[model samples]
Target chain A: MDADVRQMTWTELAALCTNLEKACTKQLKEEEARAFASLASFYASKRKAQGDASLDDLLALIEADLSTGYRSANEAANYADDRGAKRALLWGEKATKLLKSLLARYAKQKEALTADTGVFVCEICGFVYVGQQPPEVCPICKVPSFKIHEVKKEAI
Target chain B: MHAARNLRLCTKDCVCLFICPTGATNTETGQIDFDKCLDGCRLCVDACPSGAIYLVSSTYPAPQPKHPSVLETLYSLVRSKAAQEDVAHSVKEGSDDAALRQICTVVETSSRIIAEDLWRESGYIIAQSEATRALLKAMISEHGTMEGFPRTEVEELLSRLS
Candidate 1:
């Protein structure tokens, strides 16, 4: 007997929730894209890295970076398949969790900027998110990094 | 329910969509349509060219033996509402307020999601595999997360483990 014969079954539940997940994921991706773009612009004006390196350049960098991780998980999963569900799940869980942990760590890094005195700022885009307000998720370039203009106040 | 998978690294092998018995796993546009996916079918999870699709259970109990869908819920709602209205009419005519509240509560659940009944996605996790099963066990007992998956389901899983 199907273990979950009582409910809609695992297959059915997956279908219903799949769409909801897609919607949320799309929003998240768009946010990520904008963040990368904004970061790229900041670097361009500050150090003036090179000529016309837009947000796409940064995204290309990210894609290049993640290729190995993506490939590794697939390889691991294949190895697990023959081994059994236990093995498959092991490979899946570890790979997924690793990525999840990475994302969590990245979020923490972005948050570290909170303690800064606000001197060195991102040059490409002079943007700062205030404590009271949530920054706009720039869809086009995708970064909300504050653009620094060298603010000089009282005695330094 | 987050990004079902990391689409960036997806190899576009298109095997998952084909392997999925139901049309649950699909990549219609550039992005995947996770909403169409049927959870627990891991055919796609196994078939995925890249282990991009990561599935996790929510912190709720397993639902009752029979989980009702939107259409089913809607039909039930209409029936419950009518029943409530009938009961309310009776109460107004000669019945008591207690009966009216009972009827009203039933009506409310019919229309909206019955939060209490909707357990987190689980019970199946126990059935996944050894590593996943182990991970799930840790999550259930160690995390102190009450998902509402039936005690029977857990018991059955434990029986198998032993």
Candidate 2:
């Protein structure tokens, strides 16, 4: 019951959501069950959408990530030791720079930027790379190719 | 280890209240009294029907040292998630549609939680070593010049960590 969402695949998450919905229904909590049903659907759709996400949706997600990065930077400063804080700062700066570049490119060639290229993120550093494949190693974090994850579009 | 309750999962069976010999779980506040709780006591934890009660380690293991490159990458991912949270928060604040707002709120919360987890994995949450302080100082001096960088927060954090 105590599952880590980060570790779960989208299908697993959808299954968990469906199971929770069933559990809620068993408890006669109809409203909660309905909410879980919706969540289950959302995850299912998100898995299907994957690389097929629209430009606007992708941009919006990137923007959201940028905001999240800023907050993480602050938290790292506050709670993390000096090394953690330094790394967080570096990550924040790099992500901001990358996002700015992406926004600029999007503004200039909206359709071209989204054309067929897949969006990949470095699992270690959160560096977003738009290409057919992620780099051999992350330029920002120096991690190998396996650590880079593909960005799946959520069907919200 | 001491027992704690997850209020969300709690069914209010009150079995813990009766089973806890030290009365640590029988408090006006929902939280278990750590001071009164006996180490390795499992009476209340085993008695709870809803499985809401669980033990938390009173002492944490020393954090492993992460490579500087790895730490940077981990923190970067944290930043990315945090940025997403900010975007979700803005959407939540600006959208008039209730459903859209709810979705945005969820996204915001989820992203923040993920970011916190990443922070913890970076070896900065539980214990601060001297290396951590030195790293913070180096960051302030090197990266503080970047636009919109939170130099003040870093400085404040440095003082607190000290």
Candidate 3:
């Protein structure tokens, strides 16, 4: 019998999360394309909410980034490398960068993301960006700009 | 750090097996023997043609505990993503379009990832609070009679917590 999630060790949780990421990667590649509009929206809203929430200010968000965000990215990166999936590795790296950048900006008393800087999303690897244009080559998946879409950041 | 082989990408070229100084790669199970692997030796990682071998860190960084308020925010996000995932799953079920299915799958995957992050940081695993105890007790009550619930492990966990 499988142990309950709460009872499982950190290693078990890591393995399960890695399997989830690997399965997600397989689906994206086999389908020949991908879409992350809903996922991206979910994350953007979460980030915005964290920024707006008054519970202990940015400390809560910073702590979460240090604990959950960084660890998740590490697990995903290792799993992606093991599975030989460059796209998955890139997405994990992006997640780590997002967390670090947020922490840095918040520490300096600046907004992590500005209203004018648009969100550029990679269709293949779900890498999100706030920039003037999509990158020449996606750092995560190495895909060209054609595969990256400029998403609306007005609401977020 | 020592090299570990990813069997999925391993072409059975035996490159790692030949390159490993400690014979850690020439195992019956096809996995490198971590105990025998030399520290900082990445010979197999470099020699592998398929890029399957990579160095893994044996020691993980210390856990940074997040504040409960942060956990609350994460829980809210998890709930939102979970609801979105449910909607996408339903849409995928109802639609015949391949594109829709693919989109739904991506949504579902991302939602799961977010959910897992919340779960990890929620203090649900450490038995540190009443909430964790309550959750375990509830699970025991609900699935204690079920055959596949790992009742013994659950009971053991509950006992230790108590």
Best by DockQ: 2
Cα lDDT of model 3 by residue, B15-46, tens digit: 88787888998988887887799997999999
DockQ preference between candidates 2 and 3, better one: 2
lDDT of 3: 0.49
User: Could you tell which candidate, 1 or 2, scores higher by lDDT?
Assistant: 2
DockQ (CA atoms), all models: 0.01, 0.05, 0.04
TM-score of each: 0.22, 0.37, 0.39
Better of 1 and 2 by DockQ: 2
**How do the candidates rank by lDDT, highest first?**
2, 3, 1
Give the per-residue Cα lDDT of candidate 2 at B155.
68
Q: Model 3: runs farther than 4 Å from truth?
A: A1-156, B1-3, B6-21, B27-30, B34-61, B95-99, B117-144, B147-162
In terms of lDDT, the poorest run of 10 residues in model 3 chain B is B120-129
Query: How well does model 2 score by local distance difference test?
Result: 0.57
lDDT by residue (A5-123, candidate 1, tens digit) is 22332222222123222322344434323322332233222221233332233223223323543244335435434233223223323322332332344345532423343322122
TM-score of 1: 0.22
- lDDT per model vs. reference: 0.34, 0.57, 0.49
Residue lDDT tens for model 2, A40-140: 55544544323332335536655655576445555545554556556655664574457556656755865466466766666555566778988899887
Q: What's the TM for model 3? A: 0.39
